[model samples]
Target: MALNENEVLAGLAEIVAEETGIEADQVQMDKSFTDALDIDSLSMMTIVTLAEEKFDVRIPDEDVKDLLTVGDAVKYITKAQA
Candidate 1:
């Protein structure tokens, strides 16, 4: 089954909360994972790994640039799942 933006967002929220110690409720689609959440490269890599496992999507290293924001992550994973 293909993933949707809302579903991606929810999954990402859980990932972000677990990885960054940020509250899931505070994870907004408009927020930037690096700027807003202070997710460094290492943490982002971990997030990507967990997201790939959780959502069954392969987020290539090159594609990592496209997932700067929460909404960007949702869109990328949703597309990958599709």
Candidate 2:
């Protein structure tokens, strides 16, 4: 099954919540992944792994680094799936 942007956003939010111990609703799309979600590089790597597993796609390291916000992650996932 292909993942849409909304699905990616929701899935990413779930992963972020799980990894950071934060509520899913607390992660806004516009918020910074580090500043708002308190996600460090390791957490981001976990998130990338989760996303790749969920979507069955590999997100490149260069692309992963650019995903600094919820929207960016969603967009990256959508593009990767495309």
Candidate 3:
């Protein structure tokens, strides 16, 4: 079964928290991953890996750059599943 949007969001939040040393709840949906979470390129790539593993989907490298926020990541994963 494909993961739902909420699940994707939650998973991403967890990944962000684990990788960035921030609390999962601190990650707002609208907040920029880079600015809010202080995520650098290496961290972002780790997030992409975690997302792909959790959702069982492959995200392209080019698309990774576009996922700047939690909402963006959710949208990308939801779209990929569809």
Candidate 4:
């Protein structure tokens, strides 16, 4: 099953919240994973891995570098689901 942008974003927000303790609502599409969310490389990797599991999509390490903001990740995961 594929998830829409909102669903993906919400699920991702949950993951980000769990990992960083940031409120899920704060994980907005414009928020940068590194700057806005204060996610380090290690935490980012963990989030990516967990996202893959949750969304059932494969987000390659190389691709992870390109996902700078919450929207980027939501778009990537949404496309990967297809």
* Model 1: residues with Cα > 4 Å off, grouped in runs: none
* TM-scores, one per candidate: 0.95, 0.89, 0.91, 0.98
| Global fold similarity of model 3 (TM-score) | 0.91
Clash pairs of candidate 1?
A: none
Candidate 4: residue pairs that collide: none
Cα error, candidate 4, residue 41 (Å) = 0.4
lDDT of 3 by residue, 22-69 (tens): 899887779898887788999889889988888878999998888888
Please provide, for model 2 over 1-82, each residue's C-alpha lDDT reduced to its tens digit, 9 standing for 90 to 100: 6777778778887888888898998877798988877788998898889889987789888888788888988887788788
lDDT of each: 0.91, 0.83, 0.85, 0.96
| Higher-TM-score candidate of 3 and 4 | 4
For the record, the alpha-carbon RMSD of candidate 1 to the native fold, in angstroms, is 0.8
Which one wins by lDDT: 1 or 3? 1
Best by TM-score: 4
Query: Candidate 4 on 1-82: residue-level lDDT in tens?
Result: 8999999999999999999899999999999999988899999999999999999999989999999999999999999999
State the local distance difference test value for candidate 2: 0.83
lDDT of candidate 4?
0.96
